[model samples]
Target: MFYAHNFSYKTASKSLPGAPDLDEEDSLEDAVVVFFHVEAGDEDNRKGCIQKFVKNTKWLCGKFATKSVLLHSFNHLSGSKSSPEFARGVLDEAVERLERAGYTVKTTPFGYFNEFSIHVAGDSLAKVFKEF
Candidate 1:
């Protein structure tokens, strides 16, 4: 799994689940908004992926001084993406772990394309990329 995150003052995303009328907007403030791409090879060891995800997320949060996170499934970062089911599992586990750590976490619905907008803080540590 790979993640590209930005510390944003505000962010918003609308689900593009293919039904025009079904679009729903989700927004957050003072959050580390993460765009995650699950690679096809990461399905081999789910537990390891989850651990790495948590560690990397912790680092990101500490470095950016944010306690909130928004997870967005984004396969565009990699060419060898995992299946939707597998990707969802990783993302769900990550959310669970973060929540247990007492961070406010929100996730856009899985299995849907989304359109997002974010206002980044432009700090050097505000943008981070991690591979897990």
Candidate 2:
């Protein structure tokens, strides 16, 4: 499903920022893909980036194990005011969480960009989830 305005940062799809990629029903070696698509009219689109990311990370920590990897993308169609600061803040937070979970990550797309993706080792994800 897709939305255009004022979408929720957290969703049931598990497409949060730096969301671990888990096969769910399959092996952990595969990746889990989370797609966040917001319409142009959506409010708080800027903040949504970070919010979604955080939500995804929390979900990963709580519900998933290490064998899963997360691939996240916060996207909006043409229009609206998504800024670079939003992306930076979201990325910074995501990196922090990923690091804490023993996963290394990166970000891209300068100045009011689009989305981001996260990759973690199966061993690392498994290791992190081992605690839970």
lDDT of each: 0.71, 0.39
Clashes of 2: 13
lDDT of 1 by residue, 1-132 (tens): 112243222223333344234445667776777778889989898889889887887777787677788887887557898887788889888998899999988887665556666777667767777876
Error of 1 at 50 (Å): 1.2
- Candidate 2 stretches greater than 4 Å from native: 1-29, 36-52, 67-78, 104-132
Q: Output candidate 2 Cα RMSD.
A: 13.4
Ten-residue stretch with the least lDDT total in model 2: 1-10
Native-to-model Cα distance after best TM-score fit, residue 33 in candidate 2, in Å: 3.3
The clash numbers for all candidates, in the given order, read 0, 13
- Backbone clash pairs for candidate 1 read none
lDDT of 2: 0.39
Task: Report the error of model 2 at residue 118, Å.
Answer: 13
